[model samples]
Target: MSPPAYSRVLLKLSGEALMGDQGYGVDPAVVTRIADEVAEIRDIGVQVAIVIGGGNIFRGMAGSARGMDRATADYMGMLATVMNGLALQDGLEHHGVPTRVLTAIEMRSVAEPFIRRRAIRHLEKGRVVVFAAGTGNPYFTTDTAAALRAMEVKADVILKATKVDGIYTADPKQDPSATRYDRITYLQVLEQGLKVMDATAISLCMDNKMPIVVLDLNERGNMRRAIMGEHVGSLVTV
Candidate 1:
């Protein structure tokens, strides 16, 4: 196999991506499949870091909308992400891939606290570092955390794993005519109010010039193809 186009990459996975055909919570088979892909890229010399969301378990925004305290709901959401991190870690280790779960909220008994240097070190040492807890802040989404962590680690690109193959002009499921974008600019995403990432995340990437490759998570080999610089999904950049 050819060397990976990117030396280091930050993979952003939504909690829904882990749910498979189920309505809620993670599906073990899905997690194992993702682990296999991560191991494949690691074996080929790609340093991987992951920032996972918690919508499969809990979504703070949804909780808040249901008359719950925003901050408290968000904290619970963070804990959900930690659960996902541990699950992914278990899967990766099962595949014989060295892995670490670093949480922004500082659960030392379960996992290491988020330290910038420590995360980079873990990646350098050939360990997949899974960043959990979504920036340890209530207002911020995991999307922002992914962008922040990617820039902090100086990653070559952010591989955004979503259900759809790429960003569309509209909701593809709702609108059959919704078209896919092969490549798009950050400003275009914001101006059009596209659902790629939240505005904050998109703006952060735009300011820092961090590229984001949006690809389908359920499709086998899609992640590796994106990392190898193939035209497998939509490329989002300045």
Candidate 2:
């Protein structure tokens, strides 16, 4: 087999992806499935990092808009990410994959504080690192956090796993005419208003020249297919 397409990568998974069929919180089975996919790559010497969103437990922006304070809502969302991070770490470890969870909020007892250098060291040592908490601040999404962490860790690409297979011209479910582009320029995504990621996240990734692959994780084997550069989904590059 050829060498892995990337030696290091940052994977962005939403909290909802962990919900499996039940559609709430985390489903151990779903996390295990994801971990297995990751372990496959890990065994091949690919350094993996994960940044998970907290939408399944709580979306700070969504809650704040409903009456909660924006900052408080975002903090709660960050904490929720911590929960998801722990779950992911546990799931991965159960599979015998070495993993570490780092939190932006500095939860000493449950996890280590987010340290860029330490994270890189972990990856260098062949341990998967899960970045929790969204930038350790309010008014930011975990997507943005993923971008920032990707850049900080010098990852080759950011793999954004979503419900959709790829970036579409419009919501595929709502519009049958919507088309999925195999490759897209960041400029095109920004100009066309494609919903691959939030504007802030897109801007951060684009500014850093960090390539991204958007794919659907609900499908088995897709993640491995994606890491192998098998034309699995939309590729966003400058």
Candidate 3:
């Protein structure tokens, strides 16, 4: 078989993705399914790194809007991501895939600290590295951390998994006339204010020339198909 199109990729997953129709918290079934998909890609010689968000358990912006201290709320949000990371690590390991959880906040007891070289080395050795703690700082979203980590790790692309099929003119669920774009440019996403990612994340990707494949995570085999360059979703580039 031909080699997969991407040797290394960063998967950006929202914590809400782990909730699986539930009100809050992770669903074990959902985690296992994602782990199986990730393991499939790894078995094909792909190096996978993940950066997960924390909107399910806690959302910093939501808390801040409700009168909590912004910084404190953001910190709590980061901790939520760490919990999701650990849960994913468990699922991955249960699938017989070697996985590591690295945190930006230096929780040596639960995970290794985020060292760029160490993260790369883990991937080099065929271990999936899940980055948690949101860049170890408040005020930055995990999307930005994903872009930064992808650049630092020199990933071939970013697989930004979402609920929708791909980038659309408007939220497909809300707008009846919305049309999906099979391929879109970074600038177009920013100029149009599409919700592909935050401006900071998109700008970072645009500056670094990192491509992002936006696909529906709930769709089975989509991640592997994207890794194989099968035109599985919207491509954001340049």
Q: Candidate 1's C-alpha lDDT?
A: 0.95
Distance from true location, Cα of 68 in model 1, Å: 0.6
Lowest lDDT 10-mer window, candidate 2? 220-229
- Residue 32 of model 3 has an lDDT of 97
Candidate 2: the clashing residue pairs are none
Question: Per-prediction TM-score, please?
Answer: 0.98, 0.98, 0.99
Residue pairs clashing, model 1: none
Which digits, one per residue and each the tens of the lDDT, describe model 1 over residues 1-238? 7778999999999998888899899899999999999999999899999999999999999999999999999999999999999999999999999999999998899999999999999999999999999999998999999999999999999999998999999999999999999999999999999999999999999999999999998899999888887997799997
lDDT of 2 by residue, 1-238 (tens): 8787888999999999999888679999999999999999899889999999998899998998899999999999999999999999999999999899999999899999999999999999999999999799999888889999999999999999998899998999999999889999998999999888788889988888899999989888887787777888899998
Return the lDDT, model 1, position 82: 96
In model 2, where do residues sit more than 4 Å from their true spots? none
- Backbone clashes per model, in order? 0, 0, 0
- Model 1 Cα shift for residue 50 (angstroms): 0.3
Ranking according to TM-score, highest score first: 3, 1, 2
